[model samples]
Each structure stands twice: as structure tokens, then as C-alpha cells.
Target: MRFPCPDLDPPYYAVIFTSRRTPGDGGYDAMGERMEALAREQPGYLGIESVRAADGHGITVSYWRDLESIRAWRQHEEHRAAQARGRADWYEAYEVRVCRVEREHGFDRQRA
Candidate 1:
């Protein structure tokens, strides 16, 4: 399901994390849920959406108010540990991109 987010104006930040997973779960699912819960408790957090394919390819996009919030999340102790675990066992490969969202437009049939 597409996660709903509050309507935010221009100039926010988005972190797009794309990854290819390893063979099995390796505790990744639990850790991911924990991390998402933690992120929601943090300052400047906006929203997030995630999807995974049967082939173990996935993408998670998280929105933030600013870069400093992203840095803080990166430095969080539990998140650091999860990162280490991901590097060692969970993900085969991953890429992270941070972008400034200058503009956005979408259509929702329900809204219409």
C-alpha cells in the first residue's frame, strides 16, 4: 500500500534507499520495522513509503524537513547497528540518494 503523508510544500528533502536483498530474512524485517518506528519518533520526520519485489529488490523513500534531520537519523545508535547488520548480512547491494524536492504533482481519483 502507498503510505499517506501530510501535504507538504516545496523545498523538503527525500532520501531514497534502493537495495537488493540477500537470500533470506536474516532479521532484516524486524530491524526495518524497528527503524521505521524510531524514525517516526525523531524530529523533522515527515513520512515514508516502501515496496519490495519477489526478487528481493526494494526501495524505501523517507521524507524529512531538512538535511540535519537526516544526519541525526544516520548517527542514531540503533540505526548505526542496523546499518552494520545490513552490510554484513541483509543486503547484497544498496544505493542511497538524497534530493531536495522543489516541486511535486500527483493525481488521486478519490480526491477528485
Candidate 2:
């Protein structure tokens, strides 16, 4: 099970991936897990939060230390393979946005 990511400091970068799945699991679960694990190992990776609805809509936001780190993740060999598979199999439609976070504030009951 996935939980909300811990609040991170501001001035970081966030890559938001919004997607609509094609249909069925189609091995998406395994690939998605692998990608998340690989991302955690990359330099400058901070955290990630993801969720999907029963209707196959989903969003995943990955936090990074800087633009360079984001770019490196985009070009990662394994990530590229996953992207290709996503285009060919997993996602029916998707959009990506990269933004610099200038401020952040949140409350977590567990943390408090």
C-alpha cells in the first residue's frame, strides 16, 4: 500500500505525471514498483506520491533536488524502457509537467 509522501523542504523540483491507463493490469503493477524502487536509488531523489482511481486515472509526483537530477532521471536507461512500454502498452493518455516548488506547507497527523 502507498501512503502520502513526507513533506519536503521547499525550493525543490517536482515532476508530475498524470496518466490514464489503457486497461487491465497488463503487468503495470510490477513495472511501476520497479520504477519507483529504481528512482529511490537515484541521486537527488527525495520522495514520491502516487494514486490511481478505479476508472484508470492516476497521478504520480516525484520529487527531485534540481533540474539536473530530473533530467538524469528522464534519461535513465531503465526509465526510458518503461516510458516506451508506457506509450506502447500501459497508458492511454498522459501528460507531464515539471515545476519548481518555492513553498511547501502541510500537516501530517502521524508526524504530529
**True-structure RMSD, every candidate:** 1.2, 1.1
Clashing pairs in 1: none
Q: How would you encode candidate 1's per-residue C-alpha lDDT over 1-112 as one tens digit per residue?
A: 3466667787899999999999988788889899999999999999998999999999999999999999999999999999999999999999999999999988778898
TM, every model: 0.94, 0.94
What candidate 2 gets wrong by more than 4 Å, as runs, is none
lDDT of 2 by residue, 1-112 (tens): 3657776888999999999999888899999999999999999999999989999999999999999999999999999999999999999999999999999887877679
Residue ranges of candidate 1 with Cα displaced over 4 Å: 1-4
Total clashing pairs in model 2? 0
lDDT of 1 at 20: 96
TM-score result, candidate 1: 0.94
Deviation of model 2 at 34, angstroms: 0.4
lDDT of model 1, residue 19: 97
